[model samples]
Every structure is written in structure tokens, then in C-alpha cells.
Target: MAPGITTVLDVRTPAARRQLAKTTVDLFRNLLLLLFIVRYSRVALTYLYGYGPIASAKMGYAALRKSLYRIFLSLPGVRGKVQAEIKQTLEELEKKLVPSGPGITRYTALPASGWGPEQVRAELEKLHEMKHTRWEDGRVSGAVYHGGKELQDLQMEAFGRFGVANPIHPDVFPGVRKMEAEVVAMVLGMFNAPADAAGVSTSGGSESIIMAVLSAREKARIERRVTKPEIILPETAHTAFRKAAAYFKITVHYVPCPGPTYKASLSHVSRLINSNTILLVGSAPNFPHGIIDDIPGLSRLALRRNIPLHVDCCLGSFLVPFLERAGYDTEPFDFRVKGVTSISCDTHKYGFAPKGNSTLLYRSAALRKYQYFISPDWSGGVYASPGIAGSRPGALIAGCWASMMSVGEAGYITSCHQIVGAAKKMAEGLRSRDTLRNDLRILGKPLVSVVAFTSDTLDIYNIADAMSGKGWHLNALQSPAAIHVAVTLPIVPVVDELLNDLEACVEEEREKQRQAVVEGKPKAKKGDAAALYGVAGALPDKTIVEDLAAGFLDCLYKA
Candidate 1:
């Protein structure tokens, strides 16, 4: 044989080689196309099933309509009118909010000359004397959970002790570190989390929720290779979850909490589950109606699909955990449920702690590790921080710890008894009174401290305004046009007063409706609540509402 002869066994002829090369190229090209289809198909499927097949189309249409409406309203005359209305509303808000009269002065900035300590103290006392909602008189809802003199003193003392301490430097503040740990441990114990369960402290319920969502998304990405994460929650779930979705780039599937029980629909949640689902959410006595969700149902569903479940007990907080102890019947909402993976509870609410305190608990340390941010290669000595903050207020943590310890378990049970007892009484008044029941319909069977009611026959917002007129503050909700009052220890003594005010407000609204009917005209009365909600609810567009909200925040910063 020749030195470089080509044979049949060594290689095919040049024509055969050309044919093989074309076949290989064609095979590679087809593989890439198939990969593209597979990747995009998963994304399409995630959204399609996350929202119902028809819901996706409807949402798309609504979004388009809203966008068009926004553009239309942005025209010169229209925009000017809208801005003028917002400005007027803000002016009215400022008048209602800030102190007034000849002696009152707003300290918009520091005095040009530094004041002596006594001068500062005198100035503070004058500001405190200014007109404000008398929360101490028990007319306000949800804001001041427990305002007892002793508890307030204890929190103030705790804050004084740790005012300068920062948890970011735990070594520098050992006592704060211990207190924060104890606070989390006690909360976890209350939830009946397993031995391996763990948690981290947060500034508030919103941060707790955000951390839980972040952990779920990260876990799904690392473990299951999911790119587009999705979460399913009840319609009654807190707005905080929606904020979390916006922050984390997660798609949200809202299951309607229909009439009657107003609980999360298990069937809807089941239908929405997909391979990309990062989390499932259930509220323990939701903020709107104060009705606890069917947690056992959601837990079973999550177990079947192997998805993480988060229970938001921010409003329920300290009270829901002690419901049975407080001699009230309860349902499964804590870590006892088999598939429950995480829970976010606010120490600021029913826990009676300082304002900036909450906890996010996880089923295990492994899951919680996902929430930790580590920078092993950082120039500044390898930075690592837990939760969403670098330097957190140790004073708040100390205050929270003091509140929880000072109250103890027995104290919490007693407070829950008073608060829940007051709430149930209010609900009973709405349900039993013939005229009141006929005029107002309770949204759900509230078993916790909140009671929400709607009126299909009259303007509930007007009733809310009337309550405000009587110096009673209530929360306004839309989608069904309702209002709610979250009972606190401060309100426990004034339950009867609340009932009386509610009855009067309802009658007032009913009379207005009746007069409008007799005159053959639509009932039109305006108040801050009425105007804000009525306009927002009537329009398909949210641009005006968004603008007003932004403007409100801006107003808070002005002098």
C-alpha cells in the first residue's frame, strides 16, 4: 500500500464525507430549535395555568385599556384638572393633619440657634398638646394595639437602654443579639415549628413577607431550575405580598375569597399550581375580613405538589397563637400543618411591641439559608448580612423583647380575650340588630379581632366618613366597598360606643339614600374617603390613584 493511501475502512470518499458533514449540521440546528421551544414553552405554561386560560386574556385587555386611559388623561386639560384636584385634596389633608391656631408652629427644620435641653423639652410638650386623634380614648382601630401606661413605660425604658446599639455589629451589642434571638425563638415555639425550624427578625411584616418570598424563589431556582417563579395567594391576602411580588419579579395568582366564609378557595389554588410555583400563601385571620383561611386544605395541597406555603399572621400576630388559650375556638394556621413551610408574624401588632418589629420563620435552617446574602470575595472583609438590612435598630428589637417578656404568655391570653371578645361583640351587634343587619352585611364570620362589613344598599364609604366625623377612625376597603375595624386593647372598653356610632352612621347613610330616591336623583355626597374610593373604583385606570398616592407620600415630607 502507498504511504498515504485512503482506504474504505479508514475513511469514506470525499462525497460521502460531504454528506456526513451536512447531516451533522442539520442535526445540530434542529437540536437548538427544539431547545428554544422547550424553554419558551415552560414560560408560557407558567403564566397560562398560573392565571386561568381566559383570565390571562382578560388581564391583557384590562392592562391595554388602562394604558390607553392613562394616555388620554395625560392630555393638557385633563392632566391639569387631575393635578388641581390632587393639590386640593393634599391641601385639605394638610389642614386636617397638622396643628393649627395662633400658638402652634411647625418645626420644619432645626432652629438656627441650638436650643437648651429645657427649651427642647418645652417645645416637644407644646407639639404633643396639638389636636390629634384620641387613640387613648379607644376610637381608633389597629394603630395602637396596646397602649397601657406600664407597657409604654417598659418599651420606652428598653429603647433608652439600646438606643445606640446596632444589630449589624452583633459583637458590639451582645445583649441586643440575645434579645433578638429569644424573640424569634419564642415566636417559633408559639407556631409549633419543628426542632429544625429557624427564623430571622425583620423591620416589619412587609420585610418578613419579602424575605419569605425571596427564600422561596431562591430555593425553587437552585433546587428545581425554575426561571420564572410564581406564587398563589388568596384575594384577601395582605397588600404586602403583592409588594413582595413586585420587588422579586414573581408572578402572582390571586384566588378569589368569595362570599359567605371569605376564605381562600382550595380548588382555585390547586388549579393554579405549576412546576414554576415558588410559594403558596394563606392568611391567618386576614386583615380585611379577619377570617382565617383554610390552612389545612392549603397545606395538604402544598404537600402534594411539594411547594412552600407561607402563612401571614402579621395582623393575627400574638392573638391568633393564643386563641385557644384565650378560650376561643380556632383552626389550623400555624406550623402544625404538614406542608406549612414559613410564617410571617408581626410583633408590632397584637404582640404589643414597638412599631418596627416582625419575624419570618422557616421550616428548617436549610431553607432560611437561602435568604442570607454572602459576599465571600468582598474587599471589606467578606460581608454577610441576614434578611434585607445591613444595620437594623437594636432599640426596636430590645423594645419588642421587653414587650413580649413583660406581657408573658398569660398576659397575652388575657389581652386576646379582651380584644377578641370586643370584636365578637361588635360582629354580633351587626348581625343581630334588625335594622343594622339589614343595612350592613358582615363580610365573613370573623373569629379574630377585626370585623368588616359592606352595604349593597348604601354608600359604606359615607358611613366611614360619618364615623370619622364622630372622631372614630376606620379602615376603608374597595372591590366590594367595605370598611373594617381591628379591635385593640384600647378599644376593648369602648365596644358599646363603637356599636352606637356604627348604628348612627348606617342610619345616616340610609336616610340620605331615601331622600335621594324621593327626589328622583342619585345620592351624591363627598368626603375624603368617599371621593378617594369612589373615583378610584369607578375608573378602569389606576393612573390617577397612583398619582394621588405618590402625592400623599410627597405631602408627608413637606413643612
Candidate 2:
């Protein structure tokens, strides 16, 4: 402007220069004010549309922590050492997970000559005998909800009948479609769903959870125009909900399930809700603690907020509905509760179905539609799918149907009595403190098949490792540092063995600790589980856990 001699600069004197400088400062101040407004306006709008200021601030803080941790890990010198350690751990993990020992054979490629079905079956038998968790003898938890031989035989027959069937081709495999529909209907009925309720069969509990989340998000989008969706979960809710949030770009809020009862803090959940909250989740005997959230309270909150609430009964399934019949007290946590929009039931868990079978039921048809995907303008043809997968395994659906039918209501009731009874026995044994260690305590009131126990005076993870050493596979939980056993039909008979091993493991750990204390050592009796959960619990930085998890997944694919 000075060079061009504009009118303003043409009057270049001391006073004029001072005036120009003043104007410049004023402009800069205005700009800063504008920036401040924009930043705060976003937060204000976020409060108006999403989680309120307190929750938003919490989320922002968590994000900041994550970003800072990421930055810390990005340093070249620090990264290299950490990576080297991770690599060594992964290598050791590979040996343990994908081991090739004396009796083990690694099949990296096909043989020169083609093998017959008999040879393949023989190889499979050997492969099955490899060092494993021994789920068959009821030493394993949650996994392999194997029904009796008769039920398994029926499921196998159904699978063989529909081995090549795909539900996507409804016309071609109408039987599979019918079986799926019937399975859903039967499951919904068991959950006390309304006449207008509808659902779709999914691959498993994870898929069912995914679809329920997707439906809630979509419904919010269409009805409330909520773009920035947020979901609320109990601290003990299944991890699938978090996975769904990550995949679907939804904000997740966790409300602590406090000690003693371990129920979701309803007040905290209420505070977390905002206009953009698409879903609220309560676990019907959530995986870790196996304690049901207050579904009635959740329902009241959902009704007041007009948000979809999902009951994750993937672990509960057949057992929960029949708990009362089985003489086990249960909280209301299903379609019977108003404001509960969806439920995820793993047919594989308690429905006595084959693995890879579950159902997601909606309270109404309108809610179910949101989970569907359709495109009429495709080049080839119109494409539509009920849930996530387009071409689902009809065999699994058939097996699910067969299992449900064979078991019927009576069989499920019997199973509930057996499994939940075993869980009750375990819980009773732990609480008795006469047979088990007095230092250990049960986590909350587990009303379902899963019974979680923690110890104030003992390292729970070390106890888990000791149990593992005794050929028992149980889930090690963090946050409270506990272990859980998911009672199944198989575990029902071996409940005594489980309690005995648990008591022995606790005593073993106590002795180890006593020895370490005498040797002037503070920490002792660390095993695979102890080290794993201890690290996971201690680290505020989860990058190590993430790295380990990724490597573990990679190991799963190794031949």
C-alpha cells in the first residue's frame, strides 16, 4: 500500500502510522475473538446435539490423552526399543499359539497327491488333539456351549443337509430362509417379545450386536437427524459394543459399574445422555462381572430420553429367560421391559445351536428396517441384505433351528437349571469361604451362568494362571482384577472339580505370596495371565495392549 501510494498510506505521518498500527491490532483482536467463538460454539452445539458439556469434556480429555500417547510413541528412539520388545513377545506368542512341537504337524501347503476325505478327517482329529484349552472336559469357559450328543448329532445332520445353502439366494435355498426366520421368531418369543416384534439371524453375538448398533444409529439419523451419534455402555458391557462404535464412527461413553453391586451407575448414564445419543446399552449379566444392569431403571431412562436401549443377552440367551423357572432370581432385561428396543441373543451360547449362530431382535418392525441395507440403482441389479452379511451360512441357521426345536422350552429350562445351578454352586462355594480362600470375594451378584470372583488379599490373575496350570481355562478380567467361569451344560457336571481347583489355586497363590514376602520380595507368583492382565491394568498407555492384540490376531492366521 505504501509503494502503491493508496489514500490511507498517502497520508504517511506519525499520527497516521499510529492509527494504522491501532487498526492492525484491532483486526488481530477481532480475529482471535472469532476463533474463540468458533471453538466454543462447537462445544455448545455439541452439548445441544450430543453429550452434554461434562461428558464432552471427558471425551475430549480422553482423546487428548490418546493423542499425547500416540505422539510419545512416534519418537524414533523410544519407538525402536518398544518395537523390539514387542517383536520378541510376538515371536514367543507365535510359538505358544501356533506351536509346532514333537507331535504337532504344520500344514503350510497341499501334499503332492490329493488326500481323500478320510485322510482329511484323520488329520482334523489329530489337529483337534493338539495342546488346547480342553473345552470338552468342562475345563474351558464360555466357549463351546456344546449341547448333549443327541443335540450335537441333530445339529450336525442339519449342517450336512444345508452345507451348500446360502440364505442370500432365498429362491434357491428357501429352506434356509425359513429356518432362519423360524429361529428368530422362536428366540423372540422366548424373550417375551411383542407380536409386532421382528428380527434377523446373524452369524454370532458380535454380528448381532453390530446390527443392533447399526439399527439404532440409522433410526436416529432418519428420525432425529442425528449425525454425530453417541452410544452409552455400562463399564462391564460386552466389547462388541465398543467394536461397533469404532467401526460405525460413533462416540462411546462408559459409566462405571461401582463395587459391591457392580450395576451400571444409572445417574452417570443419565448424565451422559444428550440429543445425539442414539443408543443406550445394558448387559443382561454382562460378560465380565456377569451382573445384570438395572433394566427397569434403564427402560425408564430410555423412555424419558426416547433413545433406543439394547440388552446384550448374548451370554444370557436361554438361561436368563428361564432363570426364574430354574429358581434363580433374575432382573427384568428383555423386550418385556418397555423402552428396550433390541436384544442380542447368541443361539450358540445357550440356545444349544451350532457355533456362528445368533439373533438380533427389534421391539418393532420399524426399528428392524433400519438395520437393512438396500440399493435399487445398482448397475447389475438391486442389492439388499437384512443385516451385515449378504451371503450368510444357511447351515448355521439350519443348525440353529434344529437346536432350538430339539431343545424346546423344556430342554432350555432344564439347561438353565443345570448351568445356572452350577454357577450358583460355584458362587456359593466361593462365598462359603470354608472350602475356598477367605481372601477371595465374588464380584457383584451374578444372576446368570457366569460367576466372577476377585480377591482383595491375593493376585486374581495369579489365581487364574494357577487354575490354568490345573488344566482349567477361565476368563481373566481387569478393572477389578477378577476371573469368571461361564457355566455351560458341560461345566454343570464338573462344577465340583472347578471349585476344588479354584480353592487349590488360591491356596497355591497364597503359599507363593507367603514365600515371596518371607524372601523380602513384594511381587510374586506372576504367570502368563498375571503378567498379561497386570500389564494391561497398569498401563494407562494401551498401545502395548493394542500391539499385542494385533499380533495375537496375526498369529491366529498362521498355518
Candidate 3:
């Protein structure tokens, strides 16, 4: 039939014409609805499939618990009581943290007139002598990674020489620039990075991680046009990753690091991968448990998914790369592992550098450019920065470079052997000693310089408080309630004393538990750590805990 004849026949009747127009409108409406569904439901469907039913149910339960807590806190009498208790807790915290006595002087404001150099020096000496944790005596965990008095003198000299130099003006301070480049190059070589790899120096570990996260996010946005970015992180990964996600407005999917191995769950990480997953993170001996995640496993997943993988060696630093040379057990975590796009290592920790230096390395220079900040349209001039800070202290870079140069690979290997050996000895004592073995169990198989342990038969926080009373400062972990001692160079000589104190604390806590049971008491009396962690863990909403932490921070600034 002819086209004109068919059109004439089809539209010959008024009812037929009306039906055709209605059908056309219906088809257009249906097509628009289908497009809307596909666009809006993609992310939701990905989450459903990725998390599956069991994990989704757990998430739902957690949300419900949080909601219930909000309702409970809103109750009339409950709110008042909780507020009063929080106030009392903050007061106690302030009193303990802020020193106030006749002998102590508060410098709230600057002096009306400048003091002489001798007067300033005297004041500085007095301030340094104020009573505090004896980190120099190895009583504190992980805070001071001292490289010895000679290295300290070298660092001080470097600082004194480059005090006013800033790396932002490389032309003005070319020596500082050269030192910073050398520091990055040296660390990249340690991590087995390729020749085309590039890196930048940051203030510390947290900034390095933040830069890595930012790099991944920016790359995803520019290359894949992924606006709603998400990252998969092991639960044991550093809190800095969470801070980065919060700052960058990215979603985080936390895969659990279960016990026994306490490594990231490979299956869960694989399940969580989706189109929006810009990055996957695995730690090289995470801070809490000192257990390296299955980086090889994560690498395979990252390669298969075509997403970036970041290995956080901030804690491991110089120690991890030298593990094999130091004759210790090791795992594949650095650039030698395929599909690892970036790594963050703290030169400050194990590198024996000053506290303000760390490096973020990339597998390729192209990936690192995503972390750079540039503004060409500014009226002032074309501006660019390598990282978050505009003007970084060249003094820190010089100090870090000097430390690295002084403590060469041979020195680092020896340091690693000493620190790791001490840690292993502590773990062995915990396992073999009578009181410790009976009450406590080590978390994971720590292959590094940190040994974390928890107790099933006794309160771990009570043990922590007891250690504190004995002039030892240990790190407290939550979720499973544990304590960790990060063995540094200073702690190498005092391992036996640490083990002895730990044994005594365990025995004391155990005896107290037994006495409480015999007396028909519900529980033993709680100490400061016990009470603080206990209350924090029991509440579903962490607002009170946040407030307490904020109060502690405020006390640090109180004169």
C-alpha cells in the first residue's frame, strides 16, 4: 500500500485519531518514567546488591538503635540527668588534665614588653621540666620515636638553619626543595615505586592520607565522571580515612576486620565494589592490631574492578619495607603489589624524622597531579600548590632529610630488628606468663612493632588504668576493648619492665573480679579508663562521648 493511502485510512475516523494521539502521549510518559527510574535507582540497587541482606539488616538495626537512643535522650528527666553527669565528667577531666598550682604559672597573654634572651631561655627550661609522662624513659607508647641524642642534635641544627625557609618558593630556597625531593625519592625507592612514580611531602600521616583520598576522588571525577563517589575501607584502617571522607563528601563502606587474623575481609571488600567505588584501602599493619591486611588479595580486587588501591604504611613506614632484610615475617603491601595506586608513609614515626614530615607516593605521576591545586584565573597571579598547605616549613623537610640520610638503610634495618624483637618478646611473655596468659589474649598475629591484647576474664580498661598508675601510658582501643603498646626505640631497653607491669595489672584485675564475685557484688569498681570507655561503649549515640572528647581538647588549651 502507498504511504499516503495508509495514513488516510488510519486517520479516517475521529475515534481512531483520538486513540492514536492518546497512545503516543502514553508512550512518551512511560519512556520518561523508565529513564527516571534507571537514573535514580542505580546507586540504591548497587548498595542493595553489594551489602546483601545480612549486612543491610545489621545496618538497619544500628540505625534503629541510634534512633531509639535519640528518643531516650529527649525524655524530660533523662536529658537533665545525662546533662548533669556529662558536666561533672567534663569538670573532672579538666581538673586532671589542666595543671593548676602555686608553683605552676599560666601564660594566657603575651608580656607587655619583650623579655631578654636569658629570661626567655630560663622560662623555656622551666616549662620543659613540668611534670608529664616520662616518654623519654619509654613509659609511653608510640608517641616519641626517638632516634638518639646525636640525631636529635642534627635535626635541631637543620631546623636552626632553615627556620625561615618555605618550600612554596622553590626559587627562593632551592636547597630546601632539593632536600624535599630527595626525601620523597628515598621513600619511593624504599617502597619499590617505579621510576615514573612521583610523591609529595606533607605535614604528617593524616595529611598524607588526606591527599591520597583526594587524589582518588579527583581522578574518578575527571576520568569517569563519577559524582557520587564512595570508598571501601577496612574497619581497622586509620580514622584519618573517615576524616577525609567526611571532608570530601564521599560515602564510606566499612568492611569488617574479624578476629583470629583481624585482616580485612576479602570477600566483603569484593562485594562492596561498585561503579562509584573510587578507592579501596588496606593498611600495612594497622595501628590497633598491628596486622597487615591481605594486600595481595585487595590488589587483585582493585585491578579487577579498575579502581585505585591505597596502602596506608603510615604506621609501618621504614619498618615494613625492611622487614625481609631485618629477618622478620612480612607481606606484600607496597608498590611491588600490582594495582596499588598510592601509598602514605609517615617519615616521622619509624623513619626517625621530625614529627611534622610524611610522604604520599603515587604509582604514576599522572595520578599524583590530581592532588595538586592550581588557579590560573586569579587576579593576583597563576597559583599552584602541591598539597593542602600553601607555605610548608622547609625546616621540617630539611630535618626529615637529615634524619633519613643519617639513619640509612642499615640503621633502619637494625632499628626495625630491635623494635620488632622487643614487640615479639612482649607478645611471647603475654602468651607464656602465668597471670597474663590466664587473663589476656593477643589480638591477631602481630608481625610488627605493636602488640595489642584484650582480656575475656578481666576488664582490659582496668588493666590500662593500673598501668597508668604505674607511670606507663598505653593506647586504648574500642569495639573489642583492648590495649596496645607500640614498641619504639626507647621501649627496646625496657621491655622486661613493661611485661612485668602488665603481668601485675592482669593479676590485680583478676583478683578484684574474684573478690567482687565472692562478695555478691554486680561488678568490681571501675577506674577512669574503665568508666570512660564503658560509658562511651554502652551508649548508641556517641554525642556524649564527643562532648567529653571536646572537653578534653578544651582543657589542653586552658591556661
Best by lDDT: 3
Query: lDDT tens digits, residues 273-352, model 3?
Result: 98889999999989999999999999999999999999999999999999999999999999999889999999999999
What lDDT tens digits, residue by residue, belong to model 1 across residues 58-176?
Answer: 87788899898989889999999988987887788777665566866767787899999999899789777767788989988988877488999999999999999999888899999
The residue ranges of model 2 lying beyond 4 angstroms of the native Cα positions read: 1-77, 101-105, 435-437
| lDDT values for all models | 0.90, 0.88, 0.93
RMSD of each: 4.7, 4.7, 3.6
lDDT of 3 at 175: 100
Rank list by lDDT: 3, 1, 2
**Model 1 misplacement above 4 A:** 1-57, 98-109
Query: Estimated TM-score per prediction?
Result: 0.90, 0.90, 0.93
lDDT of 2 by residue, 1-559 (tens): 4687656463468888898899999999999999999978965774544455676687678779878878888799989998998999899999888877786677788798999999999988977777787788888898889899998888889989999999999999999888888989888898999999999888899999999999999999999999999999888899999999999999887888998899999988887788879999999889998899999999999999899999999999889999998887988988889989999999988888888988899999999999889999999699999987877888998898998888888989988988888898898988886746487888888889889888889998998898988999999998888889988888988988888888888888889899999999989958898898898887657988999999999999998
* Residue pairs of candidate 3 with colliding backbone atoms: none
Best by TM-score: 3
lDDT score for residue 361 of model 2:
94
How much is the lDDT of residue 327 in candidate 1? 92
